[model samples]
Target: MMNKSSQESRVETISEQLSLFALNLKLEQIPISVCAQAKLHMLDAIGIGIASSHYDFAKNILHALMSLQESNDQHYQVLGVPNKLSMRDAILVNGTYIHGLDFDDTHAAGVIHASSSAMAALLSVGQRHNINGQDGLVAYLVAIEVASRIASAANGGFHEKGFHPTGLVGIFGATVLVGRIMKLTAGELTNALGISLSMASGVMEFLEGGAWTKRMHPGWAASSAVTACAMAKNGFIGPRNTFEGRYGLFNSHIDSSNLASLEKCTNGLGQIWEMQNISLKPYPACHYNHAFVDAAVTLRQENAFEIDDIKSIKARISEKQVPVVCEPQASKRIPKNSYEAQFSIHFVIATSLIKGKFTLNELENDTIFDPQILALCQKIEYEIDPKSAFPEFYSGEIEIQLKSGKSLIHREQMNRGSSANPLAKHEVLEKFYSNVERVMSHTAAKKFTEDFLNLEHEKSFINIMNQLKVN
Candidate 1:
């Protein structure tokens, strides 16, 4: 058996290996497919960020956060907002906006919203430093890889322990992204992750009250990571065994940690790209509802059942998703607020069936509690699927019983926007146009879309940020 000291070394060595990958990975070495996917995920994040900025919670958070910033013309843009703030403040505000809708891309295997933190850091820092598109993508991939691997190693223990993996695990990735942009040496990058350990934190308590704190997790993580990197650059010292120390992440943040899997974090370093596993959302609800959204939409489209004809609706899903989306069934059936409705699998499926689509507008009070949607929600129920391959693939099945005694069922193993089943470019663009047009004139939205699609050709990040704002 390995001694306690040797175990600590093993963890530090893996952390260093991750640091080395971030320090050395090249833009050219990224696969063509991974690059395309990264760009798509990036575009999706930008679109979601701007759309979420229109929310009252996001607006209030932005206002509250900027007030804390010392006024200066350092000039970093917040998505969909015309004004600029200091670099750190901009990263925090925009990062919060990106995840406010809970619509950002996620790595299913790790149950982590990796892009929210990584993309926010990349955009705020990348724009400020005027980093090129390829370089930004490289940084994004590296950071997400490191964070997701660590999350995967934890084997869902973090969430069991009440930590939002996005915030807790994401700080590490955001730190690496900042380090990448700042050209930190491998040693410096290692120290950045080590320093970030002290700043990383987020709890699942937001679920209790439909609180807004969960929306702040990724943004806070991103901002904190930036601070960690800045400190590391100044030669700050941190515990070297940040991942496996007696009081480290796994031991402290995750319940009954998976040391065997955690030990394999560096196994495939540069070879098995984790970037490809990220999934984009088609609906604004919690990702646990994605497959059910598809099933509901299909039930609406394929069958002509009227409200009077439906008897009941039941969803079968991975047991692991119950705590997040289905449990508290009574509360989920009649959500207390819009934010609560977004996490309610019952509300999401009912609305999807009633309206034929689940969009950002579906969460409105008038829509969420529509008499028809509520009536349907009352009839809806969920059952756990013990065979579920959760944290690997999110899949679901919907069963409908008609008053006429006829039964209809729909099942989906691959969600609408997974790599195995992706939205067409035009579909993603349609999403972008819908989101951008909310804040910009039709002409400006179209123009900005074209320009952003060709962002790599632009010489300055200023041009990109300029287009992001309403003209």
Candidate 2:
């Protein structure tokens, strides 16, 4: 446990170190491998953003944002749309699109999707400033690096406190990224960090009815960060001890017993590169349900038993993930929409078992109501895995009992795409191409992918974003 004296001593420097790192970061300072990984992650997020443009929810968000646009004189491009929006509005829409599918990259230890907000903020701010792609890439790295560390220090405590770590911690990264791109002073950057605390918020209530609010969290955080940075640059003042004070973020949001070190926010800032460990998603669903999907798919592949032969199926997951993916059992067993289906372990496992795979198509209305999948879902049940390694790898196991008294079992100790069991660059590229091809023509997607992979050579990112438009 961190003693009071040690905790207090580190509070003042946490924001200071984070701000300094953001302010000083350069493309050359980051390792080549980290830069490559960051690009891949950011590219994946951009692909998802483009594909989300075809969804009703994204169209609704764009319509709402359009009504709020201040002027036509100052405009920025929206990914996969011809219509332009104000810079902040573009970030709001773009961030939502990137995270809209729930398939964006996640920093496992932090339990937050880091790249969605980073990509949105970087593209909007970078375009407005007309910054070179190398500098823009560096800014992108800064955002994820800072945000992942802050959230990781919580040790998944934010989720326990009913807060979504991506929104609660993502604003800080967006703030720093905007500050970095704008060339704000260290003191101004620190003030932006403090100002963003008030803007950071996302509750678990969205889980109740599969509310669309969850999809908007990252965009809202990035939107809030733009406001915070502008306020800070104009001489606004905010509390310096944003994370450690009596009424600060962790103190107010997390229970006393759950508090982790504030030092974790700044430890190894420039040296460790925590963002490098962020994981890409192989499925367009909640990260919590991924391992179980893998397990079910494996079991189905190995055993030729018919779905009718299964007497019962049981799944095991960490206790922490129960609320997010399993319970309320009624909702998990019968998801009302794609959003709910994405978060339902019962639905995911059943779909993987029956179809021998789970993909974006599985979330469609017809698939959600498929008789075979629904039958398998009825036979599936869950139990807590006492030995689970959660908030690290999202471990899971599945066991199926046959009517003939045969049992089949499989376990995924480390979910696919995690740092410990990383996806190869080719696999990440394959996933990106798959997402982009949903909206772009084959030739367009191929060219866009080529340009994005070699982003540092481009002089203007806006041109790159323009290629994503569906028409």
Instruction: Give the candidate number with the greatest TM-score.
Output: 2
For residue 273, what is the lDDT in candidate 1?
A: 85
Q: Please provide, for model 2 over 180-238, each residue's C-alpha lDDT reduced to its tens digit, 9 standing for 90 to 100.
A: 98888777888898999989988888999989998888999998899999999999987
> Whole-model lDDT for model 1 versus the true structure?
0.83
TM-score of each: 0.94, 0.95
Q: Per-prediction RMSD in angstroms? A: 3.6, 4.0
**Candidate 1 lDDT, tens digit per residue, 112-171?**
998989988988898878887767778888988998898888887887778899999899
TM-score of 2: 0.95
How many clashes show up in model 1?
Answer: 0
